[model samples]
Target: MTTSPRRPMMISAGVMAVMAVVSLGGLVFDDRILLGAPIWLKPFKFALSIGIYFLTWGWLSSLLTVRQRLVARVSAVVIGLLGVEYAILITQVIRGRASHFNVSTTFDRLLYLIMGGSIAVIWTGTLVLTVLLFHTPIADTASRLAIRWGALISLIGIGLGGLMLVPTSQQRASAVHQVIGAHSVGVPDGGPVMAVTGWSTTGGDLRIPHFAGMHALQVLPLLAMLLGFLARRFPRLRPDRTRGRLTAIATAAYAGLVALVTWQAERGQPFIHPDGLTLSAFGLLAAATLGAATLVIARGPAGTTVPEPARHTEMAR
Candidate 1:
């Protein structure tokens, strides 16, 4: 079989997908709970997320030159690190203990050390990969911009996750706390849970921006591509600059939205309960975003047409 840059990532995705299924099955068969969730549920969600991440990262990496061996090695490291984390999480769950913030025993402390170290490595690898992609040339200007910005935003989200461990005002901060409680703000961690995330909906949850920002890698690229498609259907916007500009505005709005929500959460405000001031803030942002989008997209052929960007040179596998 021929080797390719995407091969390692594809393999990682497949393996993680299988693990996701196993964890899902465990949810039904094992009947266990640790830290307010069915033990397997954490692994199930994580496995699926990792599977998708590998697939996306692989695709993005393939776009860069010299991506083959370098990307493969990085992918290997990432997969290995994630695997260790998954194992530790599952092990702790099986022991009916929380995987994170568990300093209860020597074994738990060791496991925590291992997990934290592995995560640090993964974060560094991701940052390195993002930097490589940012420098790589892509003739498709909008796509290149999208990928770079997406990766940047994703890194910010990862950094936000690191903040969760800072031991500053952890929800329900108390004596028994091994570390910081990652959830809740005005209230405790285990109190009220939202449907999907099981995070406290009534309190500030850092996961909102963490969730939105991480997906920028996926969302921005896809949105940029969609604008390209739309441009084709509408000849008036054909200069490519229009589409590119529109994409940029949208990306800015997306970033702003994440920031706004994160700030709101930091204030210990429930996402569901936005006061008038919050509503006004959101409205202002929305209006500005829509106005910017309208200005860019409404331009016709009469508008100054920028020189068409060079066509993308597909990276050879």
Candidate 2:
């Protein structure tokens, strides 16, 4: 197996991790507001998440045998663009202003443009990498599911974030009044929060689904692998069959959860304040998933008996 080009990614992760820590340090000293949250806070958190994301994906991507040149090119370009995005976000932090959803001044708009373009490049690179990954002969079924599902689910998260970028009625008003493309749907982005994540408690926050969906890349694969490990521990169990079914079950549950959060947000409901309808929907999903799992588990892997060659001899004799 070709040793993955790991050094470059290791370096990138190290640098970004340092930056995230530094950004955290900046929060204590720099007192500025971009929306209601501290300017440095958003960038600091984003750096932390994106840094981890890159590192995790880097390790996972190494599992496959994509063209070294293709991997290098995509990694370089994506990492570079992400760095630029971090730079712009940090720049806004220092300026004591909004980075995303900002259209107040011409310069702010230009910064938003650059940030958007940079993200577009990064996402495009991610898509390209996903396509490349599909063609490769990933060793295990569990890993194949992880690579394919992770790439697809992560893109959905990206799409949710893109949806947040569009100007809604409230966002349009906010754009004219303060910033453009607010993440909150019914209310402004900076509205009352639930302490952490800055997701609005007072009204709809589009970030909830976006956040949930984004991490599928990490979660689904881990779940699948864990199931595989557990199956191996059980001597009677078939690892391949169990892993596939478990992965399918997990993916369905995960997708339902993401969609549920999106639905909850769209209705201007906070994460904690899901009404009867939400509960009902969730119950239905749970029941369906349970039913599917029950059937798959009971059926197990099909057992085919190979016809003995001795039958022919017996018949002739």
Candidate 3:
């Protein structure tokens, strides 16, 4: 079998995917509820998320050329740490206990602390990987920018999880503090929620922005792929610089989206119930993104000359 840098992460991702499927099955048969959602729902979500996360990182790590050994080691550690965190989360879920922010028992608190610590280390490892990515050279401008911006934005998204750790005013004011943090603002955790996602409909939910930001790792790269595909049909999309610029604009717009949602959540506004000001902000962001995209397309090559895509040297397994 041909060993590759992507192998381990891909394996990890597959395991998570299987776990997600199992968790989904549990949802149907377990008939358990926690924090106003099905008990297995959190496990299912985490499993799916971890699967995708590992998958993305697998592809990403395959692209690295510099410091191969170091990157692999760091990635291995991050993946292992995530495994530990997920184990704890699933254990809590199976026990019908809240995985996050639960301080009901000393054992639960210790498990929560371990989860937090593991993720902190994982985040730091990801930072190292990001730095290594910056140092690695890629000939393709569009792909390069996509990878860089995607990684940086993902870090921002992951960092937002920290906000959920802060004790809400309600948690602080209550005489008996069972939970330290909350996912919702302007309302308690267990309340009227949106379908499937369980995001609070009555108040702002931090997970919305956090989810959007973290997935940039895939979104930006997919955008680059989409542009590449479109280039065959449109001569104006032929230029590499044009695609790179477009990716930059998209990254900025996406970052703006993250900021906008974060701001909205902080203001205690539900995502579904955005006020006029929020709408205005969104409109502005949309307009600017559209304008920038238009300008890039207009300035792109009028000729249908497709240049060979830049090739990145893959790291050794």
How close is every model to the real structure, measured as TM-score? 0.89, 0.87, 0.95
Cα deviation at 86, candidate 3, in Å, is: 0.9
What is the C-alpha lDDT profile of model 1 across 50-75, one tens digit per residue? 88788888888778665556666787
Which model is ahead, 2 or 3, in terms of TM-score? Answer: 3
Better of 1 and 2 by lDDT: 1
Q: Candidate order by lDDT, highest to lowest?
A: 3, 1, 2
* Candidate 2 residue pairs in backbone clash: none
- In candidate 3, what are the lDDT values of residues 1-317, reduced to their tens digit? 22455789999999999999899899999998787888888888889889999998898887777888887788889989999999998889778899899998999999999999998999999999899888877665677788888899999999998999999987888898789999999898988888778889999999988898899998988888787777777877777777779989999999999999999998889999999999999999999999999988887778757546432212112
- Which 10-residue window in model 1 sums to the lowest lDDT? 308-317
lDDT of 2: 0.74
Native-to-model Cα distance after best TM-score fit, residue 178 in candidate 3, in Å: 1.1
Error of 3 at 317 (Å): 13
lDDT by residue for model 2 over 1-317, one digit each (tens)?
43454566777788888987888888887776666876677877787778777876677567546687777787888878888888888887778877887888999999999988988888888888778778876545555676578778887887788877877775455425446566776776776777648788778788899989888888877766565555544532344555566677778788899999999988878887789999999999999888988787677754422234311111011
Output the worst ten-in-a-row residue range by lDDT, candidate 3: 308-317
Whole-model lDDT, model 3: 0.86
Over 4 Å off in model 3, which ranges?
1-4, 304-306, 309-317
Winner on TM-score between 1 and 2 is 1
